[model samples]
Target: MNPGKRYLFAGLTVLLAGCTQPAADSPPSGIEAVYTDFFKEADTDRSGTLEAGEIGASIDRDFAGLDLTHDGVVTIDDIYSKEQAEPPGSTRNPDLSSHLPYDTDSDGRLTAAEHRAHLLKLIGEMDIDGDGLISFTEYRVTRRF
Candidate 1:
């Protein structure tokens, strides 16, 4: 992917994850707090952790918005097709990405498990403090590796 597309895809991925991070100087919030907030929305069973079934249930509702062709799966081609159909000079940022969002298996097809795993991967990377917690700065500067 080109730099522009890569940047766009990264932003879309973050938006889709639905994370909330305060500024670097703001009061820190525990990873559990953020995780709870995130999982609460996706964990339909209130099981404290998200399951593939719950993730799929949520995705099923959202998939309709992305599956423009109603193929039951979204691909990069589908994204580009939507891009072309948009009006010229359109400033709209699509929720889809060519980086193959949430495709943990890298089959180029997104599954609910893949989506959940991707979020877990990102959460794993957020605890930069190494103190069993994430500082506000760590969450704000999530790119720290």
Candidate 2:
């Protein structure tokens, strides 16, 4: 092989190899790591992809937490109530940004169906491949609140 052609081929090979993704067994970093943790928690069946049921189950638990009043629906008052109950200088105050928009019915209340809609929207965004499955990488690009 000619010297120049050999060098070009070597460079191309290295570039293509670099483009390959890291092994799934490899530990993740930064946002990918965070999403990895969430994916593991949400992938209850260990199917590798997050399905609607898994997401629903997880979101349902979260919805229960948000509904502090136990009235079966979440309202702005409930959110603010939690925020006001926080200790002074508490950075862990409730963030309404994560809740208000989920009220799809716009009746000033958030229900389980509404909450599921928002999460399903997230999953739609995460399904970049349009395979009806959300992978950890796709989930990494999307996060509520």
Candidate 3:
């Protein structure tokens, strides 16, 4: 092969090799799964946390359709008072007031380190087995509102 062709092939090979390596901060599949499930379930009121109920209630009251009986109590059937379910594609932050406050830096984005620390803390809180692992049931129970 010509010298130019040899160099070109070598560069291409290096690039292809790099594509298969695992990412530097990639989380384990199980941990990621737990994070996803717990976040979705625990953020029940969708206010972000448990405490967002008051804020959500205020917003609901302002909507015309919320008070079906006009009695000030928001029943399940009262569509106006209901908080919208979380959207499908993105992870929404739970209301901070509900349970624990998020440790977001002033800029409003979760740094990689923050994300990892949060996950570890959650695992520690939810792990009931004493084996340093969180079972699915334990995870579910801990995340319940």
TM-score, per-candidate, Cα-based: 0.36, 0.61, 0.29
Q: Report the alpha-carbon TM-score of model 3 versus the true structure.
A: 0.29
Per-residue lDDT tens digits of candidate 2, residues 1-145? 9999999999999999999989979897887677678789989999888887887788888789889999998887788776647667856434444658767666778887888788777678878899887876677656631
Candidate number with greatest lDDT: 2
Encode model 3's per-residue lDDT on 1-145: one tens digit a residue: 9999999999999999988846747643665566555454544555433223432343343433444556553233443225577467965444422222333553333333443455556656876766554455565568662
lDDT of 3: 0.50
Those runs of model 3 whose alpha carbons end farther than 4 Å from true positions after fitting are 1-101
Winner by lDDT between candidate 3 and candidate 2? 2
TM-score of 2: 0.61
**Could you report the Cα RMSD, in angstroms, for every candidate shown?**
15.5, 6.0, 17.4
Q: TM-score: which is higher, 1 or 2?
A: 2
Question: What local lDDT does model 1 show for residue 32?
Answer: 49
Candidate with the larger TM-score of 2 and 3: 2
- What's model 3's lDDT at 21? 43
